[model samples]
Target: MNSLTHSSTSVVRKASRFLLTSRRFCDTSRINGDEETLKITWETSEMDCGFAEEHEKISVRRTFLESTKLSASQVLDTLKQDCPGFNTKLALDELNVPISGLLVREVLLGILRRLSFDNKTRCAKLAYKFFVWCGGQESFRHTANCYHLLMKIFAECGEYKAMCRLVDEMIKDGYPTTARTFNLLICTCGEAGLAREVVEQFIKSKTFNYRPFKHSYNAILHSLLGVKHYKLIEWVYEQMLEDGFSPDLLSYNVVMFASFRLGKTDKLYRLLDEMVKDGFSPDLHTYNILLHHLATGNKPLAALNLLNHMREVGVEPSVIHFTTLIDGLSRAGKLEACKYFMDEMVKAGCTPDVVCYTVVITGYISGGELEKAEEMFREMTVKGQLPNVFTYNSMIRGFCMAGKFKEARLLLKEMESRGCNPNFVVYSTLVNNLRNAGKLLEAHEVVKDMVEKGHYVHLISKFKKYTRS
Candidate 1:
């Protein structure tokens, strides 16, 4: 061999050694990286499915997401095969294992619906826990059905926040939330009178495509009525016709209430006619509320007409129905007619309450029938229903009006003896009666006591002194 050939052979030998070692290292690293990637993908896919074995998780999840055509029972049967008694709590417990998001939602929907109808509280709680786990990834169909189920259950459990959350989740899931659902939520919130988040959720729901239902309009009317937003209420009614939702009985009732609150008698009559024309007869509640409003407002005879109409329509009047009518008559200064209703209410087996007694007593007081008012007070005591402050105040004022200051004083003493702390009205009644009877010193003393106690008797006391002067 020559010198040049030997050097070239030596270089080739070194190059071959380097290539062999580098190739082995490359092959080992490639195999390790591929194994790690596969393991991670499997774990990730398993985690997506709630928790079944890693191998079964993907298959189970696919089956469940494709289960829309299956009935709830059929879906449950499939779960039985895969998870065997697959409730939400059990799925949540299998955290170490894996199921897909879609499958977890399926399990939750089935359990929530079942538990909702069954009223199984433990199952409901577990379903809710799974709901929290599923977060917001539930399918639109599942979201709608589950939220409807939760609304019914929430009503039973009185879980306002959960009801609101389910509403938000349903809207997020692209389900078409309608006014009926919003109405249900609003009615529940209104009855509680202080659910601010429910109000917020309702306003948020308005941004969606679902039109408000008649009941929903009524609820909003009521909420507006609570805050005395009369103008907004009027606008809402106009918007109702524009929205293609025909106002029903509830709608008419709400409009009547809003009208009465604003003292819009013309509007009230129009709405009543509208209701009747729509073939919707007023219910007992309708008559009761309308009568109460008319009696308290300046339209007592209109209330009587409504009461008669309620009877003509074949709706039986409840005890509340009669009480409202009597209150109206009393406010109208119809003492005799009020007494007739009181007798009829008892004849119809409806027991009169303190409110009924107070109205009748006030009626007699207004009509200058002091003897009749005193007799009613005795009957109230005999019935073991202690006279409230209004009852005593009425009798004292009646006696004072009758120039029977002595009797008024005796009742005032009796009131204090019964632990009925005299309010401003009570003190004013006594002062006015005494001053009118020419007992100015006694009237002045009552005024001094009223002022010292920080009672709100100044308005009435000032009027009494002015009258005497």
Candidate 2:
């Protein structure tokens, strides 16, 4: 029979049993005997279980799953006392219910409690397992907690993309999330391939009553620059302005760098003017980015102008800023200007690091000035900055280019003795230099060595097309 028919039958049987049970305790008394029989029957018929109440009880049990009485602290303490470096999965299985709520605070505090490991990444992995349990249960509240915790773990561990996914899930679940949550989501999106989702989701969330925070706007702005979405970046800037939030230095930097990438150096300068007009004091990074554009771009004059402007504005140039300027001048074939930056770099009380020496050494090598390059290399060693592969490679290439093959071969041997294996460029240089010196057999031997050492060696290849016959 169908369920409804079976249920009706059961109800009839229950009503009959209630009538049979009540008849023993009741009597058809002297007065109104027929009416009393009717009244007793009606009372017995009315004695029924309320189906709505039973259904509601069943629903409450099914939906909430008997929420655990265990606090997170209690769970953690029990796990620590029992497992003590053992995975919590084994311990969780032994528990009747799971922990949930305020995931960020719990996870951050939990990790801090287990700060014994040197690496500390294992703690995050454990956190991952805990959250996976929460997700599997499909408990929105608990799942939200897990997502929140995962965001923190991903943020601290620099797994930006994973954090973004968690935020997306939280949004989809219709949780009343915070601006900080969305900001982190945007940042994580910035680092990953699916960065555009951050912006789209943020805009969509406006219907849910969230206005863009500074971090939200900044995240989208920064991410746009990452993917070179120039058009959208401008659109976002306009949107931010309309939202009543002024774009800050960070926004300007992204726009400037994006302009630089698009070969719009003039536009980048114009943007810089906008930045100044907005009363945003250009920070060190702003100057650094501009210096990078000037130094790396085909505009040494613009770079020099920026350097002068920086000095006038009292923004002291660090070793890195000077390095970029020096390297840029060298790349532009302005050796004297390069040396001038180096001198000023030292005079400004920023001591040159190995990077500075390497730049100048590379410049000399590119100019085919072997003697000056070697002099700089030796000077770096004398100043107690140990020579790295870059230092050795620069000197070796300089020797090879100057047609000093004998010195190049000796340097190669010295490199090997010092545990520095010659890379592709070094091998190619040796082979080509030997071939040009009329030592074809030696060239072949070097090619064989490169193959055995797993270095790429195309005998007919050119390191520079100018070197080939």
Candidate 3:
């Protein structure tokens, strides 16, 4: 209980000091001006509260030396006061505490633990400076654990540059990067979609005896998918196989995307074939890929066929999947077909979402079926789907296209009053609709309003012509 009490008090005291030193704190390297208070609700365990256990796995030597959380501001102040110019060689040497002392090292490591918001990034710089200083101190060579720990601090805080520096230092020091470090680094890169670095870290991992072959590869492939690095994605897949790693479902799906992205239709199909041949079924995402491509290609019939194929193959269609097909049919100007398809989707137990309604409504509008579109728009509101700006835009554009200038103008007002902030399309549609209807003065007023609202005129000469008219 005494030790626990002491430890908690020390952390609070460090944080308290920073709050008092407001002047010296300025012009200092802080994260942002966001303040965070660290709270420790849990105190000592029953063992500490009552009698000492005859046997406890706890070693006081290790326990006491283990670095604990201290406020970041406190760490910064301590370093500036005690280890002034921490990055400086002279300052590190002139410190009262020995440069290589455990106390100093503890403080350096302490900056990293349970760091609050605004503390993470600044604390990282301090830790790295300590790491740099460790190299120069003959008595203070950093262990691999130290190397890994420093990298973790940087990695979690999204301090990639600092993380890379520490990794380079680890390699330079002849320290064999552990599987632990490699996996963490690779995972960090992949999670962040650090596309370029994924391959780099994997290549570096090859130098280590322990290569994390599963999650590491998955992480890289997933990240590569994010950045749309098709070439690198293919290369990584190929190299992963060359390294005697089996591709998982995640791996195949990743390669499928790469193939699709690179316009390799044949290759894409081959990948899909290989995925099944390898005994791994494509997840909903994989099926969505096929649906997406068909929809995007404007082949609504083909898209419907894929949907039917998905159902026959036991892939339950979500509202999202149905929405994609609906959008494809809508874009094709097949209002009847899209409506029938939406009904089929509803019958198939997929309730229409707002997107589905919008897509179908857009189709109706596109086909000069304004009344049906208006009814659906109202239905969407009645059902709490809450028509968004795009929905309003479509209706406005539809009215304008149909030469219903009065309705379009009223809709514009409604959109503004509803706090929707009609975008470029809405304003442009209204102005052009007015002009086309020969209401030149009304169109000119809209143009003036648009200008006042800071809307950019993409076609200045067009505006001049309108003004002249």
Candidate 3 per-residue lDDT over residues 1-469, each given as its tens digit? 5654454344233212211555555443553434322112223455464445533335554554453222323344555543443445455455433433454446555766546566676667667776676667766676777777778778867887666667676777687765566556665765677746747665545445444436466666675566566788898888778878899877887887788668787787777777776777667777666666555555565566556656666777788887876776677676777788788887998777778898888888888899999999998788788777788889998988888888888888887788888777677777777877889888888777767766655443455476533
Best-matching candidate per lDDT: 3
Off by over 4 Å in 1: 1-220, 223-236, 239-248, 260-266, 276-281, 289-315, 436-438, 448-469
Q: Per model, state how many residue pairs clash.
A: 9, 0, 0
Q: For every model shown, what is its TM-score relative to the native structure?
A: 0.46, 0.49, 0.49
- Runs of candidate 3 with Cα error greater than 4 angstroms are 1-214, 227-232, 296-309, 364-372, 399-409, 416-469
- Residue 170: error of model 2 in Å? 5.3
Q: Residue 420 lDDT in model 1?
A: 86
Winner on lDDT (1 vs 2): 2
lDDT of 3: 0.68
Q: Cα lDDT for residue 191, model 1?
A: 60
Q: After aligning candidate 2 to the native by TM-score, how far in Å is the CA of 414 from where it should be?
A: 6.3
- Residue pairs in clash, model 1: 48-100, 48-101, 49-99, 49-100, 50-99, 50-100, 51-98, 51-99, 52-98
As for candidate 2, its clashing pairs are: none
Instruction: Give the lDDT of residue 429 in candidate 3.
Output: 74
